[model samples]
Target: MGKKDLLSTEPYKGVRDFYPEDQAFLNYLIATFRGALERWGYVEYNASILEPSEIYKAKGSENEEVVREQTYTFVDRGEREVTLRPEMTPTVARMVAGRRRELGFPLRWYSIPNCFRYERPQRGRLREFWQLNVDIFGSSSLAADAEIIAVSHAIMMALGAKQSDFIIKLGSRMYLDTLMQNLNFDEVQGKKLLILLDRSSKMPAGDFERELGEMGVSLEMLSPKTPPQDVLDVMERLKMMGIENAVFDLGVVRGFDYYTGVVFEIFDTDPKNSRSIFGGGRYDNLLALFDDEKVPAVGAAAGDETLRNFLETRNLMPTYLPPTKVYVALTSESLVKEANKVAETLRQGGVAVSVDFGEKKLSDQIKTATKHKIPYLLVVGENELSSGTFVVRDLVSGEEKSLSRDGLLSFFLNL
Candidate 1:
């Protein structure tokens, strides 16, 4: 092939290729997510990225625009339509229903899954990203909704975020439905008003009012009223549990049609990056698509890209340290074998170690180690080989210590 015809080095637009530092941050986010979820007794779950397209088409799955425009759908060789999952709720519901007879009640599950969506890429929105999905199944109580929100709060706090850094805005589909009933609006009018309410925050005031008027609803009829008692009760309960940042927001109509009860979105309070970090809500009837009976489920999903942006805005991103705790440099080409031996010994002692090849000069090797941010650098030379001792240099502190093999092992073990 001609050089000009070679493939481009850039990744597909709207996706990312994580280099070491990027991957380190991603790993840190994933580890923090997994740790927080597991501490709450939530088990991990996963499934194939490809699913039958009908799963999303089922009643109350997602909005029509998502299935029609955003989803990556194609017909496979089997003459059946397949879709790269745009979200996890539908797939998880299918799995739970398929094994409902064998599984126990109140299943607490979580998954960090990659989701695909074909949308205009913006600051917080991406076509491809990883999301941490946390769900609890077979719980109908309002406490389950509070617990899911609690888990969301816990994840933010675990990342060294304070309550002031973000706010949780709670809403309810049932509450909205009741409001519509009181106003004597039919289902068609109610649905239109919801779409308007969901987009109200982004619309100009005059434009929003005109749209509502076009739907035959007056501004006076749909003014910002006090939150209903149920929402207030939930807010009080959350505050009692130390999650003091939650409040009622009538505008939080989640895009999914499956959400039947309380809904919420966690928003970053920073004006520069002001947006919903992640959100999920009660979809008590989602599993009904697969089973005769419905399962009461409440869950939420947080995107890693958006979470990283939130951390950056707050200056809370974790430091990226090299995975190798120690780097061994050889004084001469002859000591290559000895350096490898020492590295192997440290590995056996449960320390992460790497040995430099003899092709590079000792100074160059130390520079490479420092570039990687390795914590310690050990030099293997004739004196150390004969004296059964080595000088370990602390890269961060710039201190040198003479240590035997046992002492070196003890140092890292203590760390």
Candidate 2:
């Protein structure tokens, strides 16, 4: 055969290759948020990443950019259009609609799943990342909205974030519609204005005003008004619930087409990560795409990339801890079987143990244990086998102690 070509080792652009240390940090994030959600009676659910393209293409699912430009769409051998899901809201809505009759009302569900989007890779944007999606369905109560916001706040707090570290910006589609009607904008203008306003924060003030001027609407007309009663009630509920950081900002219009009522976004207060972390809003009519029935829902999603950035900027990243608590090093090749037996014994006693079968030097074995961040190291050899005792060394503190095999097992089990 001729010379073979080697494939590149790099992963696809904008995606990540999570080594052990990286994975540990991700696990910490998921575990922390999941614990908070479960405490609030939010059960977990998941779905396949592949979804029918039509779901996102529907007018009520996602924004136009996602469906037309950002989704990873393809055709299978059978010629059916498929898309890797860019978000979880549409998928969850479909599931609820599919089992509308069998399921109980007022469901609170959350999921952390990997999502794909064909977008430019930047500080807070990626082609692929995992997200935590929390939603409440079947309830039109503004209490459900408050609960959703409360759950989100709890997640940040659980991750050791203070209320001053972030602020919740709330808004409503009902308020926007009233403003539009008073501006005498037709249907086309209203749609255009919403799109422009969605992007207004990214544009300079002069440019935003110039664009409004071109549309024959002055910036003064867009001034904030008294929020709709629904928005006010939700804000009051949030305040009563002790979520004191929430504030009304008409500019919090999320970039989703399906949001029908209240909307909100969370902003990191740190200057280094001063940007919208994540947000969701009420999408009462999303189920209409499936049938005439209406299901009111409000939810939000936290992306891992932005969440990690937030934690790192604030020095709140969790320390890495290896799952294996002890490393059993072999002093000689002759002790191979005994080493495994000791490892199994500790494992049966509920201690995570790793056996060093290579029979390297004692110093090298200790180095290996330290490299893997294993806390305790035990040496198994002929003396230990004869005396029925093992000496366990603390890799972290450099403290060593001699104990009977039974004592070693009990010590780790209790720890």
Candidate 3:
């Protein structure tokens, strides 16, 4: 094909192509969150991106705007409607309901899955992104709610975030429902009002007030009311667990229709990234869509895009370090065999090694190592091979240390 006919190098709009460095940062984020979740006894689970389109269309799972507009949905070759999962909660609910007869309850499950949405790409909101979802099933107690919230706090801290760096604003759907009932809102009107409140932060105050006026409600009527005891108890428990930043805010109505009880959002304290990092809440009725049986569940998901933005805003993003620990630079083409032996020895000792194979000048080989950010450089030349000793150069510090083969293996292994 001619140049004009060549495909553009750019990724599709609203999605990302993760280059090595980008993937390394994503790995770091997933690793940190995975460690925290596993420590809390949460096991990982995953499912395909394609799920039945009707799952999102279900009344209790997602709202109509998301189902009708945002989802990447189409009829598959099998003549069945399929969707690239826009979120994970419905999929997990389906899985749990499908196996409810065989599974043990109070399940602590987690998943890091990439979700898709057909929306305008913006900071923190992408058309394709990965999310760390942590959920607990078969528990209706407030402790389950508290524990799920605590897991969010723990994951944030694991990423080197301080309590002052973010705040958990708690709310309850039950409390919002009560206020709506007092305002005499019927079910349809109540749904509209909740969605309006969920978008309140993004809309202008005048617009919000005018919309509430249209709904025959006033700003005063929506002002902060006392949260239900379930919300208060979760907040108290989080405080007792040393998560002091969690506070009750009456405005936190999570966008999903599934949330039946206490809901929350973790917001970055820094004004530069001023938005909810992630949020979830108790949804006891979602499983009912599959059958009459209801399974109580509480969970939260942290999006990789939003989490990275939060870390970058606060300068807490971890540095990307290549997995290769040392690069073997050969002095001459004749030394390729010796270089391989040295590389193999290091590999046997659990040290990541890369051999230059005398393809470049020794100095250029060292430059290649530096370019790749490999921490150590080992020059395999005639003298080093004859003496059975290698000089390992620290790429960062410019320090040199001579060691025998065994000593070199021990050094890299210890490092």
Q: CA lDDT, every prediction?
A: 0.88, 0.88, 0.89
Worst 10 residues of 3 by lDDT: 59-68
- For model 3 the TM-score comes to 0.94
Clashing pairs counted in every model: 0, 0, 0
Q: What is the lDDT of candidate 3?
A: 0.89
Give the better candidate number (1 or 2) by lDDT: 1
Compose the digit string of candidate 3's lDDT tens values, residues 184-266. Answer: 88878888988888888789989989998999987876665655788888988887898899887767898777788999999
TM-score between candidate 1 and the true structure: 0.93
Candidate 3 lDDT score at position 6: 98
- Predicted candidate 1 versus true structure: per-residue lDDT over 1-415, tens digit per residue: 9999999999988899999999999999999999999999999999999999888887543355577789888999989998899999999999999999999989999999999999888898888999999999999988888889999999999999999999999988888887788878886788888989898888999999999888777776554576666677678779889998898877798987888888999999987776688799999888988999988999999999889899998999998888899999988888888888888888998999998887889999999999999999999999999999889999899999999976888898787
- In model 3, which regions exceed 4 Å deviation? 60-64, 203-207
Off by over 4 Å in 1: 1-5, 60-64, 181-188, 218-225
In model 1, the clashing pairs are: none
RMSD of 2: 2.2
